[model samples]
Target: MQRSAAISLTCLISTAVLIKSSPPEVGFTLANSVQIMALSPGDPNSYSRPDLAVVTHTNLKLSVDFDAKILRGWATLYVKKCGITDELILDHKGLNISSILNDADDTALQYVLGEAVEYGEKLSIKLPQSESSNNTYKIRIHYETSPNASALQWLQPEQTAGGDYPFLFSQCQAIHARSMVPCQDTPSVKSTYSAEIKAPANLTVLMSALREEVIESDGATNTYKFNQPVPIPIYLLAIAVGKLESRQVGPRTHVWAEAEFIEQSAYEFAETETMLKTAEDICGPYVWGIYDLLILPPSFPFGGMENPCLTFVTPTVLAGDRSLAGVVAHEISHSWTGNLVTNANFEHFWLNEGFTMFVERKIDGRMFGDKFRDFSAIAGLNSLKEAIATIGENNQLTNLVPSLIGVNPDDAFSVVPYEKGHTFLYYIEHLLGGPQVFEPFLKSYLDKFKYKSIVTSTWKEYLYEYFHDKVEVLNTIDWETWLYKPGMPPAIPAYDNALIETCKHLTKQWLQWDENTSCPFNKSDITNLTSNQRIEFLDELLLADEILSQKKLETLNEKYDFDTIKNCEIRFRWLRLCLKGRWRAKVTPALTFVTELGRMKYVRPIFRDVYAWEEVRQQAIDTFLANKDKMMYVSAYTVAKDLHLDING
Candidate 1:
């Protein structure tokens, strides 16, 4: 044939190829089945309609533009056809969609975005194939997130510890993933992913996936690649770029942070290897390859976020004595509970947090002692009681399984799930004749749901199935109350009363001295108590039937020098007592403390507690306003809503 004839035939064949795709040769086959056990209400936090096409693998090729504070990327989703739906819908909020294309570059897939909703907008990609010839296809979306994308936090040069280069990080939990990329942004959908991120050569890029070798650059741009061998929910997706450094803590663990904090962060999380061993011994082998941590700046709101490989943590956990390593233990426990096995949706969030808290305590027990674990649990119980009282038991948010329909999952966030969920698990262990019988079952449960998501009902079904012999005993417990009833567990857990009562006795002695004006105790009495004991003591003191007098407040502070304590946990409780007693002299220290720390765990409540006093309410508001710009979105909003102040100004 002539050259012209050959070219014409080739063009005809290319056109045919663009119209449809051949089936995927190998992949997780669930993409072909319709609705393979996603949760009810199907992830209230996301706008994506996953029933149509379930994304299995995501390839993100992006440029991190620090100058513009944007991530411009081609999010190519490899989806498996599940039903007869006309279009594939993905979740996207505050993103600028530029174009969409099929595998063959010649064909641009027609797309339309719905009016932006709170969670995000729905991106609908029209399918070209009309028959079963194509079972899978790749949809490449070229888009850039807005400067104010809620998921990405952009910090100025001065805001970072380095004081040279700007910093950027992404937090996609509780539905914020939609703001970063268009995909099935629900926990109900899990998918493996690979990322190729380009940034300035001066900075480094890290993600939730394994840190593969970094490739060379064109001029000043550096390209980094990562591979997530295990499938993860969208919320576990993460990315960070900054003047970052890393040092190995354990064999498989590395602490990634700014240069100034690398050594201390490594020291703080040194025991991660032991925690990982304990967790695996309890719940199957650790599947996700390397468990490292990213110690974020002061503005990171949460103590730690369990984001698969690189768990994002706040620098505050660097308390020199390693007292705060519990946060690391908690995040590592998520490797088995929250990350490995996940909640089906935000409503059943306890499935993630509760189980993580439980495992965290167990690991703590193994590392320290059983008494150390009880000290933590007793503290957790006090928190649970306070949380229930604050939220009001009747409010559904206090329930283990909350009804999050039409509600922001963040609004419903509380300690109820973490504490109450752990209690429920503890109750189960006790009823099943303690740890020997229960620990093995825990491993089996995690193994059964590995790489999967489940609702509260699903967890219960597995519970009964796993303990076939003890099904009758499991049934004896008040299942409805634990699963559905709001506020507190069906019955309070019996914590190791020794230390808790000791703390209470110490407080009682101090309170009696205040009342009688002849207090027998002095600061020397508490000097010997451990930090955990001090925490419990302060907590119990604050729960006194009557407020302390100004003179008594002075006496307590002078004796213990609570104002000078180094631990933030103890310092926070001491400050709260001052606010409660309206101790005027101590107010300045509270304001100073609140301004410097942006962790919501401390900032929000301290703001609210101090704001309750009319004399210094404005001061609290002023302090918050002065530092609001420095706070994370999570911290800023929680304080604003709790105090009824609009922080945007």
Candidate 2:
């Protein structure tokens, strides 16, 4: 029942022959290998010239020198000429290049390292003229990553929990991969890779790939090898080395963290197998052979990076109640949505994030309930509206397909693509009658675009083509406003109000808590509600616009005591509300709380608000200056931008 590559070729060739008498078509055909002429336009943010030659695979051998704070490595890239001349350009940032050689002939190759730009320096390698379009060559470059490599965060032994050895990890998304490894540094180009990492024997190494038992350290150092059979985008490339260990939490899933955190890490992510199974039963089989979770240090930037096999997650998700496991579900959902089918460019990033959000909620719905899904969606809806307003409704970044040309991709990162994209898909499901009616289209969409990157145009085309005669339903969609217009979508998808109505009622009561003499909601009331309900209540209060009034904050905090909340999500928001409300007492604890965890989801917004408090501006500055080193590059870069501080090492 599966359509193999050969059948695909035959079908395309047959169609082409049939259309030959009519007109010249725009595509090509079948054989032992089908030539992919229509590669995704690729990321504009990258310095690499992928149009000239495409990288097929990469081999990385690096040694982590903790004392020197560097990763010295040589990268071997195998590239194929795309019916072009003999020159290849790669993206490199702050890398010390020693030499370049032709792997085919083992001879020196002439190269040029261009001036550094916003993304990186362009490394151009001259190669022998191509014998044909299929001509392939290997270029090996000897290099060492700069100490200030943005993607890599090197931590001293004292900086980590173990305090016995140094820690190093990579956050390569959004063009940072170029700083660590020279390549296209774009999500559009996926290359299967193998990594041989040498590190201190006292540490364990893990990457976004399969791993085997490491022989006990021989002496001062140990070597770890990883192989990713599936081709993955550069952004998905990741690695971590520290006093790490793992424990099997599911049939096909494992959790990795430092020895002290391993047990709790396993418990938090124990439902990964269930999530994977539910997702497969909903969409299709999970393609990635094994699913594993790795808990990075508190400052691991984002909530989770959905690296193909190994997902890098933040330590904040370990709330002891598993209330934050939704993040794990989100990452697992990416295995199907992002890893399998990627967005061709950051301009149309919603295809990756949006679909993942949709599938993630679907899996969560099955695991918990429809109420849970709608509740989460409602919270996300608030965030989307806030993001749009924050960016200014007229800003193009609020669009489903934002323009990334001549702009850094990182600046456009927001919840618009995520929530808006989900809204669009949910709208389509409604148009087609329901999810059941639209289920096949979802599966087929994944099947058609599996292991490939695509732009919005391709997605729209395939969607229309799938519906065939019934494509008329799509005609109802205002594609232009929904896809291009700033602000919000033309229409809002209907959410089950049943779940949020109670949460909304409680929020309203709290908003008037200062005016009311008696309140039905007490500390027991807080305990009675779900963790997500607590989040919803706090999120609603943030919109009261009367946050500057300390009277209300004192009354609320006195009764509920949000300062001691265990749920990180609720606790962070409450602390933020205190700052926004000018609750002077909150400034100290807020400073302390921000230092405790560096998860952007919790800390970035706190810094942004506290920085604006004016009263505690210097306090905020001093705290960030003190702890910025503890933050990940992505989070630190963002905070620095918010505070207009230079990126400090």
Candidate 3:
């Protein structure tokens, strides 16, 4: 006779309260003899017990309800029972769960929604004893996302470029996926997923998967099907709904955006296919069949998110000259470094970002000589310096592997991982010969860890194993200081200074010039510099001991037309310089720039600079308050902390 398992609803609810009150070190046992740990060993931001039971595949049937600003859906999860556990624990933040049912028999199952915590809440479900010996079972959860889900950003028609239809997109990096769907919301768990999303007939829906087909529409809504065969962490799950159009840029790539941006986006990313091919030549193979780009609205926060098969980018990168296309290369590199071999948790984020940064520059070097690659590395070092100063020299967050036990991963985000991580790998490459020797190890590393999530220790073990002959050389380096110590790396790489010297010379000339001296610079001074070089010039000026005088700034702007530049990178640095120089006339323009687009790279610094100016501090706070609702959740949250505002408020 088959044994049945049933849990009392009241008892489960009381258990949830007890779990909430317990400390992080506590563990609770369920009625079905499974233990729910406070946090996963590899992922402190989640409450899922993947060691016991993990989701292997997910099938989502969600409908976009723009009126309600929510996603009503049912997620059917195929779970693999890893241990002798009869209960499954998932992560959820704010979801209205209606019912839980066994897929095979359609029998109601008992579950409990735990009290909320810093990351989210624990969702414990009792599993029925299996009659067969199979270790996998199907479980279905019926729920609706909260209107104010942190993973989702709902925009009105006015917020979009077309001003004709509303828009919706998701940013689930770190630990926000729990707000979208209940699952093993941690990078420690990788699962393939298929989705059937329904949206208004007038709008198009897209996901981080290959588009299969569109079912017949009923004039009001259309159902779109997508399948992602490559297993991915829940954080990479993405969706965008809007009035979008697409242009085929290459045999394997398409650029999607609103009608206003379609032509330019297609032109801007026309070399995407080339980048993909170059990446393949370096990183083995591009397992993701199709590579596409989605240009989100101005309010999109990051430079780009490397969702497998589809990349979500910001409009700020459309500089028209393709100078900013390096962001595209970075995302493509993630197709192998991040999307293929995953970081087990946010704590080891450098494994994802640092590896991608290293590969991105390699791709750049392959296209534009080694000097250009070294030039980019120098720029990245400057960014790392700025990040360290902002985060504090002694702060643990500056470490490559930060302790995020009680901290939100979002708060710990910075360039430390990207640059510092790259520095470590670059140092290793120098020690073990150059790219000639390191390139093979790169391929080997990806091949061994493909389709799996791993921690830093695992990666270190593999690295040492790969370079066994050089164990003596590796031991000579200090691992503890590099990985755990705060502040910048101990040593900087010998970057080629050929490209940066020109920018530095121009910066010095401007810095030494006096207000009384005849404006020594002319238009020809910067005419020969590339867009990236111009940005480097501006960055050097910002790091000076004193801000340039207002007169000098005006003269500089006059010669270079910095005030009217379209490239976001140059414009961001120029705006910060103006504010630092106390150029009152540019304050309004600076506010306009911060409000216009929500990319945190530009927004956070501009806002902080303005706030630093005591005269405009209140004004900056007011601007952020009025426009915070329009910013992405991560952007708003980080900017709030930057301004010292109460996050809850």
Candidate 4:
């Protein structure tokens, strides 16, 4: 759970090295290692206390400086309470709190310094002897302090010349909001917020809730006013103010990014308006005001975060010239799915991710066409298959299901939520039909659940209500099987069909290696494929082909006389298939292909057998090197070792 703008990533790599003789033991049990140490065993709800929130007045006003990192100011809160002498507690991490006063200054309020408990510097306050209930009175507190690294931190980039970056930002989701502002930092407590943030003269300050007004600066500082009238979870509250560049998309939508990333951000996020309009066309009006995208600097982790008005994205999305529109669609869809109809706990994270992913698939399919739709669908299915593979034959990983799936929100971080959940929803959409068919149902769900917290069971129940007897297909499909009992979907004819179709048409053709069998006279069957088609084919064939059939594949391998110079992709594919099958006789030829391919500078970084390309590159390099000395591809040994050093170390 990253806090909004309150933390920095630090790598603690060490020089010490250790080699294991065998694979280490691991488990699938869901563990809350961090939370267990963070909270007291007897006081599980101590960190969450909404009962302490007492309203003296219906309205409150406050102002503070973000430069200090610590929120120090006085809040004049009017209250009415009815408990003779009990202290009230406010959500504050730490501070040098000086005075607590009332409107009359008649000393109606008293200050009883409460016991300060600091779990990574979160300071809790104690209210004085005053019946906070049913009393209309004024309360004020003066404060000053420094930034808490344990809670929040900031980066003042070097672009501001001699001055420090005036803009302030926050990483408030998941529990860090308390490090920035004083509040009942829990998902249940919703209150109106009016903040006056002071920043450098020209820099802008954007917030999580909504913008009320902005007061121009007198050449030194500016005062921005925000009125958050909606009841929102504390984690959803965010603040990102910086020297950003902004551009309008369609009518009211805007794209704001770091000054350095404006042009690319604009181009990559070009589809923002289209996506927004499509979402609105499906679900009623856009509930959140103008939608915006913020491209954070490179080090920012996570592909994107769905804040109310703003979506914070990692600059890494700028790769390969705007191919990241899928992520943009994902975030934008969150405006309705995750933000409007939120999940009460991380356990129901599927409600946020699964639904948002469903929206993204629809938007991508509509905007980019069937090719993208097909690619994305297959990609999702492939990822789910991989997840099952990692779990293994004993069903060890699958057995950890209910406990690991959503029990501890953090457990849902992997492709399990994004890919498996997506596949599940994709299956749902397959049955429900496309946009024209499911629009009404989607809109109805959003309309009914807006601003409310929900869980998976509630979602499932609501879905049943919407579908009713008209959709008996739901009865045959068990949603719980996908969530609790996991493994790859049962081996059915469809799975084999997909495997065969993907292998036959999508993969590169293999060469015949047999010295005895009659070979085909024509070469057009091999020459007809495009480079991309060839690579795609190679991937499927190598991944799916069984090891026992390597002898037959090898016979076909030799007929083509595989040569890296003329067919790098096919040669590499043959080499990879040989390695995967672990066919001892084919090692010589696989080695030959690897060596020749390694010399080519234009090959994909993965095929180069060096670099972080997780799949092909690493396996290719490791295989060739192991067989280098005795195989026909002996020259590949040195290249593999060198590449491995560069990549692994």
Clashes of each: 1, 0, 0, 42
Order of quality (TM-score):
3, 2, 1, 4
Clashing pairs in model 1, backbone N/Cα/C closer than 3 A: 513-519
Off by over 4 Å in 4: 1-46, 51-153, 159-168, 188-192, 216-218, 319-321, 385-412, 431-438, 470-473, 486-649
TM-score per prediction, in order, is 0.91, 0.91, 0.94, 0.63
Q: CA lDDT of 102 in candidate 1?
A: 82
Candidate-wise lDDT, in order = 0.80, 0.78, 0.87, 0.52
Worst 10 residues of 4 by lDDT: 9-18
Residue 442 displacement in candidate 4 (angstroms): 2.0
Candidate 3 shows a clash count of 0
What tens digits encode model 4's per-residue C-alpha lDDT throughout 519-624? 4434454465444334455556645644425655555455445543244435555665655555555454654443332222112222332333344455656654
Model 4 per-residue lDDT at 329: 85
For model 1, the run of ten residues with the poorest summed lDDT: 32-41
lDDT of 1 at 244: 90
**Which structure among the candidates has the greatest TM-score?**
3
Candidate 3 vs 4: which has more lDDT = 3
